[model samples]
Target: MESDESVSDSTRPVDSGVTRLAYHNGSWINADDVCLSSRDPAVTQAVTAVERVRAYNGRLFELDRHLDRWQRTTKALDLTGLPSRPSLSRLIDEAIARNGAWLARQKEFGVLWFATPGTADSPTLVIDLYPIDSALIERRTRSGSLLVVTSVQQPPSACWSRNIKVRCRLHYYLADREARQTDSDAIGILVDSDGTVTESSIANLLIVEAGGVVCPPSDQILSGVSLQVVRELASEIGITWREQRISRERLAAAEEVLLTGTSCGIWFANSIDRSPLRAAGPVYQRLRSAFEGRVG
Candidate 1:
């Protein structure tokens, strides 16, 4: 066991060779110093909400949008002891400055915001930064990603609305693990109980057809900020965007499949469950170019 005294605060920005600083509750501290008790709800019950914001070109992308979603999720989960909006915003800026030297060396990175209901005293709020996996992004961009449809079904809305992003994602973990059993590089895509394609473990799925791009209804999947950006970009380019329930057969027949998330703005999918689909089709190429232009 480590002694609490050894975790004493540093007078200057703290760095452990890997991470620089982190915000815990209302104070900025060493990344490793942010700890939670084993009994905390975030650990014991998995009652935590998280928002991952990507910093592109050293600037946070869609920060307000990410923060809005985080607020909605924390409120839906009734998480308490959160900092006010202004305070949280200022802390984010300070965290970036604290990690400025490290961040400057990387092309892109991620800002993770975590909130959890705590013991009797207070809630847990933390902001941490991490480097993006450029190698993985490069590989996926070249060959496209394999999305394996997993046996694990998405939890019903009765459990919690799909709109609220929470840490209760054992299903996603199990699904991804099951996918890796088939192919080490495969990512898992969960389906509804009725066999409608919902989303991948960490991204929203978009299907391209002759008519337009189709997305899963908001009621069935977490509305991703990246997905919204794609929608806007598509509209600007005169591409139609619609929502519908996508069955496995439709997914197999899709002209192209795209994945959108905070870290990866847009990426193409090569196949699903070993059935090869078009990789980086014309639609995907155009959207990807547009996305890159937007980010740059």
Candidate 2:
């Protein structure tokens, strides 16, 4: 695992061996040197699409699926700044090579890419590679985490970036802050306008009932890559899965609940609003084991 110690301040940019980053405009720079302009329209108005890819064994996992979703989101939003899959693949390869040493020293990391509709009437792309906090995952995996359903809900419009992992995240930030105010490990769960459960601040939620495992339909959620893997694993393991409208009450009452995301992987929820649950339920254990086997 990578050392948690901070890097020295006196090291030169090149000698620091920072992860390499590529933009749509063909600039290769250190990840730390990439900057976001305050005057840019995307920064000012929050017009951007994002995809977070997980890195395992020093390579990107589910890179194709993440790129597909990025393309779909860009097309849907009519945002014009994105590189082709092949181009992005090349950039990713370069990034991996540049960060090879750093990644080899780490247990896991995240590759976050975003494209913003040009502010000065031009195209721009932003991408970076960063290490995942193993401590957070350890806490979540060991005892589970708390989730609070927030009052703020997703908008109904299709162009609102509800289904995309966009950079417009003020609502999520606020909700997450509220959750943290209650408990440091607590995360916010957003609901729809009509009080239907949508997803968490950073992930998709899954519920295991007596009949089968249920996840909210993609119409209202950010259809996560990890969630897709979990679905496939469930099917392979003969666990019934479905897309349905899971109410907050149903989520709170579920026999087992898990959160899925690129970084989160699969994490059981210990409680919802102080309602405790069995951290190691049989169904959860089975699904977790299946997921681990496939990922391993």
In lDDT terms, which candidate is top?
1
**Residue-level lDDT tens digits of model 1 in 27-98:** 777776788889899899899998878777778899888889889998998987788888888888888889
Segments of candidate 2 deviating more than 4 angstroms: 1-24, 158-161
lDDT of 1: 0.81
lDDT by residue for model 2 over 1-296, one digit each (tens)?
12111210011223335354544457767565666678776778887777777766656788899988888878876877466789888877776666666666556666667777676676678666666777777677667778888887776755465666676777777777777787876788888877878887667888889847898887878778888998888888888998898888888888888888766578788889778555756666777788677667
Give each model a TM-score: 0.91, 0.88
Q: Give me the displacement of residue 164 in model 2, in angstroms.
A: 2.0
Query: Which candidate should be chosen as best, given TM-score against the real structure?
Result: 1
lDDT (0-100) at residue 167 of candidate 2?
67
List, in order, the clash count of every candidate structure: 0, 1
- Lowest summed-lDDT stretch of 10 residues in model 2? 1-10
| Alpha carbon lDDT of each predicted model | 0.81, 0.72
